[model samples]
Target: MPAPDLSVSATSAVRVAATVLWTGPDAPREIDAPIVAAVPDPRGWAAGLDVPARRDLADRVLTQLLAGEPVVVLEERGDWLRVVAPWQPSDLDPRGYPGWVPRAHVAQAAVPARTEAVVTVEAVRLEPDPGSRGDGLPSELTYATILPVLAETGTRVRVALPGGGSGWIDARACVVRPTGDGKHVEAGAVFTEARRFVGLPYLWGGMSAFGLDCSGLVHIAFRALGRIVPRDAHDQAEAAGRVPVGEARPGDLYFFARPEKSIHHVGFAAGPGSDGVLLHAPRTGEQVREEQMNADRRATLVDLAGRLAD
Candidate 1:
């Protein structure tokens, strides 16, 4: 069955595991068709893009929306929707991070229940329980995707979807908590979450477990622990408390930029001191890695690190 058309001025939620937010309707390339489809294959799309093609994404993409994340639809053009993700704060739009996404990737928002289940693992597939008329096949959910809890059996949990259907996920794959709990793990734990993706490939505008951009890594790490940070490096730098680099500790954010320029890169501080090591998803064609703060990085490293926690 076809998904209903998104109405302007209404709230919507992403229905895929992850969907790329393009800069504009014209931003996507032929190679990006797979990712813009109703059922996106983010991993396959990432694999198909060679180095040059991947690098080109920096200009074409804005950010990514995880399954069930809400967006405010502002305009519609053919197969595209201009929306703002209110959960992902940004200076670009007063409402939230603004971008263009395929209309087919989202559906009208559902009224959420009192409890929600947050994905804890890197990725998990959600399927319907036997004998239940659910929606389509199993859908992949990435780290930090949150869905309202509907029911729970011994080892499986039924969750509500934005598309007006339900699916079951392994109880072991997520943690159930009261809606709007606002709880968060300590800095050390946030760093631990970031460490788990060390070898993951870097994808521009990516925020899912399949791939991540520099700021997306930090954003999702904190989010998995129930903290909401800005969605871009420059905004994140401004939101966090500034700490002298010499006093930096684990979980602090390391931002990089030329003098008098906007911050372009961000990473997690892996140790203490001015030359502390970093764990981050580097540029295109590179994988997330932990490395010492080298000379080249030092020259551009912001003198005062951004501190989200101790």
Candidate 2:
């Protein structure tokens, strides 16, 4: 589909009201248009997009947006729309995870009032009303899938869905995340939360519970614990304090990369000592699982480990 000319007037302010995908260039750029849809074009993506050096798995991917996440659209060229990401992608990528995304992946709409909620369960149904029997929404809300809180009932909270419309989700399945102190959260508790999605499929650039890449998994686990960390493995390595692998304990992160130049994959420590198993969301086609960081695996140099808390 062609891009919609939703360019706002100089005096009008704009914000994202839906969960759209960011498929822009690896370099920083921006646009002033909302996405049109969330369709993926595998052939087009591989043939046209400049692959980021840090992405581990080269599977078909799309960067997503939670409802009401703001973006600064900078420019439009052909069918691609350039925009600023709300989070950091990496140190090399400019200040706003700037990139070019297909115009088809977004549609312009009025920004709505919103609050953030994190998915607490593996998956939860989204209904049109505040009960299970209410008209069902099409998709399942997965663990760590952040949505904009709309209305709250005793046990359910209405949230704005990515595809549009409000859906009532069981409040028990999600927690309203508020901005505050996160340093008080313990590493063990964070690892416990990391253990929940033990069998999800790995996705490139995904950051939600529905499917997540290695760094995305790490990012979400910390976010669930209320501490927001960098979005990619390399950046996380720089931001968090590190511990030598031999001295690593539970709740520490095991970082893996080839030639030891940059951090690519990350796994949370789930066991103790040299015999510990690291829980991680591995690459494409692999389900998130625990792997014993024994002799052979560590040959890739699971040499560096990090602690979220210094």
Candidate 3:
């Protein structure tokens, strides 16, 4: 029998391709590809659109893929209805693979409340020793809490260092805004929201909005609206639903390894740049901040996992 093909999609980026990543197999059965064409529909990706638009989308996907992106194919409706996308592509991708081509498969993240909307900063909880820990630091960032706050449209919630353990500004003075428009929050909002829970207390296997672990915080952030995502970090990695991190959006989940095993910890990536600074929940004594996540982290977590999760 022939191997089944995976699906992928083009994120917000303009450049996307549809080159080869690799074949299917366990262990070393991985490959990389670029996006070809992007479509908001879930069924008629690169294929649905006209040649002109498809060509433009294809060129971009090629560049990114050749650049060593983790692209993959999702599904196919006959040969004409093929859906291609990056590995673990952002669930929020304007078009995740193809089913969403017509804007189906609704976004997983929830829309926060409108009343009492506010933008605030909460710290991330980290393990005592960033590198090592006494209780065997979690395999992945488990909890990064999210304050019970909301924002108004055009709300500007600013991000600032907590010099003395105080972080709350008026709606007008904030660095970002919060709303429930079903639209991806603006950059400033994303940044602010991402950084909002830095220096927070970390918990073991936590999943609450008040005191979250890495994956827990991510789950709450989007769940506030209406999106249902994986509960823990490892599964969160799988939540990408088939797209790769290379094609991930700002609000997408970023999973890592614990130098131990499985899908371990996960975080929310901010914008492109592959900075490696993921938003996650730390250990009992850590803070929820965008710390320096270097290549070493990837070497431990992602590289070993093999493929970008779906």
Candidate 4:
């Protein structure tokens, strides 16, 4: 059978099999390790370093896989599992956005039964009790992190964690919505949500509101509207129908790829023409913001365009 058209909303219940670090959509490639041994030169060493070539699977993360987030498994190649990550949806690949993860990293045996809830806050601490305490879950949960609501106590909601555990999060911090609610979401709503992260730091491979890369920003914004776009710029460009630059509208995606001649960056079209603004997270250190695509930057934009909202 052909891979399902992932451009449309589709979901399955599965969890991260293990505390596995995410490799990109493609299969993993082994490289020489021990940075010092791999790259002997010290001058301009940092600039010349190939991070993936000298790192462990744990270090090359596109995103962290929580134990219970819903995922759609697409294919299996021996020890590796190609999966469609719900958080990182794609349009080009029918199997949903492929995340070439280890088979061991995907757990499908037992998914707890409970109501689904999405984290609404930027970051929320999971606690054993409703009140703040010194000992909470080891880390804070970011926005859009899914959880199974087991119980509701005063102003707090108990939820299942990725690993084998349960914790209480503020009731106000999460919103329970049906899986089918996003299909009819509005473009304005999508753009409105994108504007909230205007000052957030750009995190490569980040899909949550706390931090996200350029494409990550676009992915999350569309997700809010209940639509899923491809995870990378090039794939997204291919998946979406083409629209000339002159006809761009709000909620439309503006892809940027220059020198390399491939889509590497993407942003939301907020206005029209030269006075129009793009909402995007530019680079590693930059924050998500709305800015005019200057002539030089706009020159590199490809004619391709996509719309996630109906």
Q: lDDT of each structure?
A: 0.83, 0.58, 0.35, 0.58
Estimate, for each residue in 182-237, the C-alpha lDDT of model 3 and write its tens digit. 33323334445546667655543333323445665664454333233444465556
**TM-score for each model:** 0.93, 0.69, 0.37, 0.68
The TM-score of predicted model 3 comes to 0.37
Q: Where does candidate 1 clash, by residue pair?
A: none
State residue 48's C-alpha deviation in candidate 2, in Å.
22
Report the Cα lDDT for candidate 1.
0.83
Model 3 is weakest, by summed lDDT over 10 consecutive residues, at 25-34
* Candidate 2 C-alpha lDDT tens digits along 231-277: 77877777777777877777778888778366667888777765668
Question: Which of candidates 1 and 2 is the stronger one according to lDDT?
Answer: 1
Q: For each of the candidates, give the backbone clash count.
A: 0, 19, 100, 5
RMSD of each: 5.1, 8.7, 20.8, 7.8
Consecutive 10-residue window with the lowest summed lDDT within model 1: 1-10
Better of 3 and 4 by lDDT: 4
Ranking by TM-score: 1, 2, 4, 3
Please tell me which predicted candidate would have the highest lDDT against the true structure: 1
Error of 1 at 33 (Å): 1.4
After superposition, candidate 2 runs with Cα above 4 Å error:
1-62, 102-115, 128-140, 147-150, 160-167, 177-183
Q: How far is candidate 1 from the true structure (C-alpha RMSD, Å)?
A: 5.1
